[model samples]
Every structure is written in structure tokens, then in C-alpha cells.
Target: MEQILETLLFASDEPLTLARLREILTPGTSEPRDDGQDSVAVEIKQALAAIRARYSREDSPVVILEVAEGYQFATNPRYAAWIKKLFKDRTSFRLSQAALETLAIISYRQPITRAEIEEIRGVEVIAALETLLEKNLVRVSGRKETVGRPILYATTPEFLRQFGLRSLQDLPVVDENASQGEEAAPFIPDQGAQNPMAPPATDHQNN
Candidate 1:
């Protein structure tokens, strides 16, 4: 069963959750087992641990990782430099500057509609939005309650992990503080400007 799980994970393009594994394994009643345990949870946990230990070996080619609450196998991080160098000239996976700006706006003003983003940037951003979606950095959270019911966008868990933020509120903000309570950048938008999607003011600065 563990070997089956490993093979399925290796063949899968996306991370597989425990529930998904259960669905696949349940139908294979004749599968062999090591611990003779009937509790699926215990067996799964044990299997995961064993897999972790096995990959801890220095010679392993792939490593299993738990990301976004699912398990997947990826080439070991130690080999990442070589993998990156192999694809250094590829442009498909890289983002353009405009796309990055659009993504920043979406990240900060998530659950926002396309119209709102356009309003803030003073430009259409369809391509940027599509690129971000393709990269799995953003997703459709829901539709706006407005007349057209435009789709709302929000960052994914992958975004948080990539940025090393524990939560959304941990995102940095430009300070407006001064000694003795004097205002700095008083004319600049406050918390609202903190939105990732907001266009940068002429004097705006990152924290």
C-alpha cells in the first residue's frame, strides 16, 4: 500500500490530500499491509513517517513534502540550483514587470473584482490576472455582489508561503509615524494604500 501511495504521488502532477489517498486505497482491498492495522488514520500517519525517513537518506533523488495540507514529491532542494540553471533561459515561467505590479495589487486587495483593480491601476489588467491565476498565486474567491457580479480574486496559501508571511495581516506597511506624533506623508492614503493592488503614489515607499 505504501509503495502504491509512493507511485501514485510520483505520477501525480499536484499534491494529493489524505482524503484523496483514502478514496484511492479503499477500493484496493486486496492490497498488502505491514502493521496489520485496520485504522486508516494510524496507517496513513505511519506510512507518511516511514516515507519521510526513507527520503532522509542522502542519496534519494526525490523528497516528499507536505505543502498546503497535501503531500507531493519534488526533486530535492539540494538540486534546485542545477534545475534552475537548466531552465534559466526559459521565459514561460517568468513574469513581466507589468504582470508583477498587477499581481501585487491583487495580493493586497484580494477578494476584489477586476473593475476595482482597474480603477486603482488606471489600466486594464486582464493578462496579468490570467498569468497570476496560471501561476497559482491567486484564485477566484467568489463573485462580487455588484450588478455585473464580477469574479473576486484572492491570494492562495502558496502566496503566503512564498512571501514568508504567517498571515495576511503580517504584510508590511509604509509607516506614517514621526517623533512626537507629527505626521509623515500625510497626503498619502493610509491603510487603504497598504493594499497590494493600489497604485503607488508618486512619493509612496515600501516598508
Candidate 2:
């Protein structure tokens, strides 16, 4: 079971949830294990734990990480320098400062309208929002319920994967010492620590 889990994690480009793992292991069935164990759920947990422990050594080059509400294998950041050299020609998307700030606001206060984001940034965010949308990092979740029913924006799963975050809960804590109405610094993932998935190259347009 551990070997199968390891192979699946290694071959997958995206994170795999426990539910997803179970489906892959035992498709079209929700029945409990016949061996009298707790359940497939418990068995998967044990397998994952063993896999994690096997790669937890100080010299391990790859590690299992929970990102985007799922588990994935990621290269160790310590070896990032060497790995980057091999993928130097791969396309990477770089976010502008304006877009970064807008994204930060949306991430912290999601299901928000464009007007609400503009209100906080004190400037128009159309271009920044467009850039984010083009990059598939931000998405239109739905519309607000109030008058006009303005569109609401939120971060995408790609955002979490790109930033190597397990979830929004992994976002950096907002500074409490800032003055009222001050815009907090945006959270930027370390270039060296980003997930190995490289987004397609697009024209670099400043926001």
C-alpha cells in the first residue's frame, strides 16, 4: 500500500487528497475493509505516514507536502538551486507589485467584489485583476447578493500550488501593528521554494 501510494504521489503533477487516493486505490466501492481493520481511510493514513517518514531523513531530496488541501511530492528547497539549473529554460510567471497587492487583498478577504478591493487599495484594480485572471491565479467565484450583485473574486487552487501553501490558513499573519487602513505587505513566495509545476509563459505585462 505504501509503495503504491509513493508511486502515485511521484507520478502525479497535482496534489492528491485522501479521498482521491482512496478512489484510485479502490474504485466504485465504499465498503469497509474485509480484514477487520478500521477502514480504507485509516489504512491510507497509515500508508501516508510511512511514506512521509521514509522521506523525512535530513538527506532526502524529495518530501511529501500537503498543499491545496491535498498531498503532493515536492523537491526539497535545500536542493532547489541544483534543480532550478535543470529547468532554467522553463517558463515562469512573475506577478507585478500591483497585482500582488490586489491578490493579497483578495486572498485575505475573498468572495469580495472589485469595488471592495478598489476601496481597500484606493485605486482601480481592473488591470491588476485582469492580469491575475489571465494567469488563472484569481477567479470569479460568484456574484455578491447585494444591490447590483457585483462579481466576487477569490484565489484559485493554482494559487495555493504556485505559492506552495497547504491552504489559506498557511498565509502569513497580517501585521497587527500597522496603522488603521494601512495596506499590509503582500505575501510573496520565495522563488526558490515554489512548487515544480511551471505555468505556461505569457506576455509579461506590468499591472
Candidate 3:
């Protein structure tokens, strides 16, 4: 089971959740035992724990991480500088300061409108919204149920993946004492790491 889990984790390009791993491990049957405990789930967790332990050595170059509500292997951030050299020539998606600010607002107060973002930033956000949309980081979730029914924007799963977050709940706590004019700090992805949580190289032009 450990070997199978290791191979699956190594081969997968995205984080694998427990349910996903179970589905792969036991394709056609229910996992609940007569004792009412989920045997497969218990075994999977034990295997994952063992796998994590096996790779927890000080000299290990990689480690298992739980991101986007699943598990995957990523190179240790301590070695990020050396790993970045491998992808130095590849095209990477870069967000402008304006776009990042806009994204931060949307992430914290999502299902928000462009006008709301503008009001907070004290500036128009059309271009920033466009950049976020192009990157698939944010999306038009729906329209606000108000007079004009302005389009509402929300962060996408890609945003969670790119930012290495398990969920919006994983976002850093906001500083309540922060000035009203101050924007939330954007969650930046670790670049050039061979981790599913890291943003992948793209063909799009930098924003």
C-alpha cells in the first residue's frame, strides 16, 4: 500500500485527496468494514503517515505537503533557489502590483463586485480584473442582487492551487488593526518548484 501510494503521489500532477486515493485503491467496492470503521481510510492514512515519516529526514530533498485539501510531494522550499534555475527560461505568469492588490481584496471579501474592489482601493479596477480573469485566478461567480446586479467576482480553485491553500479558510488572518486604506497581503506561490501547489509555467504573457 505504501509503495502504491508513493508511486501515485510521484506520478500525479495534482494533489490527491484521501477519497481519490481510496477510489484508486479500491475501485469498485465500498470501504466500510463490519465494525463500521472505514478500513480503507484508516489504512490510507497510516500509509500516508508512514510515507511522510520516511521522507522526514534532515537530508531529504523533498517533502509531502497537504495543499488544496490533498497531499502531494514538493521540493523543500529551502532548495527553491537551486530549483528555480531549471525553469529560469520558461515563461511564468507574473501579476502586477495592481492585479495582486485586486486579487487580495477579492480573496478576503469574495463574491465581491468590481465597484466594491474599486471603492476599497480608491481606484478603478477594470484592468486588474481583466488580468486576474486572464490568469484564471478569479472568475465572475454571479451578479449581485442589487439595483444594477453588478457582476460578482470570486477566487477560483486555480487560485487555491496556485497559492498552495487548502481552502480560503487557510488564508492568513487579517490584521484588524490595519488601516482602512491598506490592502491585504497577497498570497504568492512558490515559483519553479516541482509541486502541484506551485503555479505551473504558462504560455501567457506576463501581466
- Candidate 2 C-alpha error for residue 72, in Å: 1.2
Q: How many clashes show up per model?
A: 4, 0, 0
Ranking by lDDT: 2, 3, 1
Please provide TM-scores, in order, for all candidate models, with all chains considered together: 0.57, 0.75, 0.74
Q: Between candidates 1 and 2, which one is better according to lDDT?
A: 2
In model 1, what lDDT does residue 71 have?
A: 74
For model 1, residues 119-193, the per-residue Cα lDDT tens digits are: 988999998989888888899999988898889999997765444344566555525244666543322223212
Give the candidate number with the greatest lDDT. Answer: 2
lDDT (C-alpha, whole model) for all candidates = 0.68, 0.80, 0.80
lDDT of 2 at 155: 98
Clashes by residue pair, model 3: none
Q: Give the TM-score of candidate 1.
A: 0.57
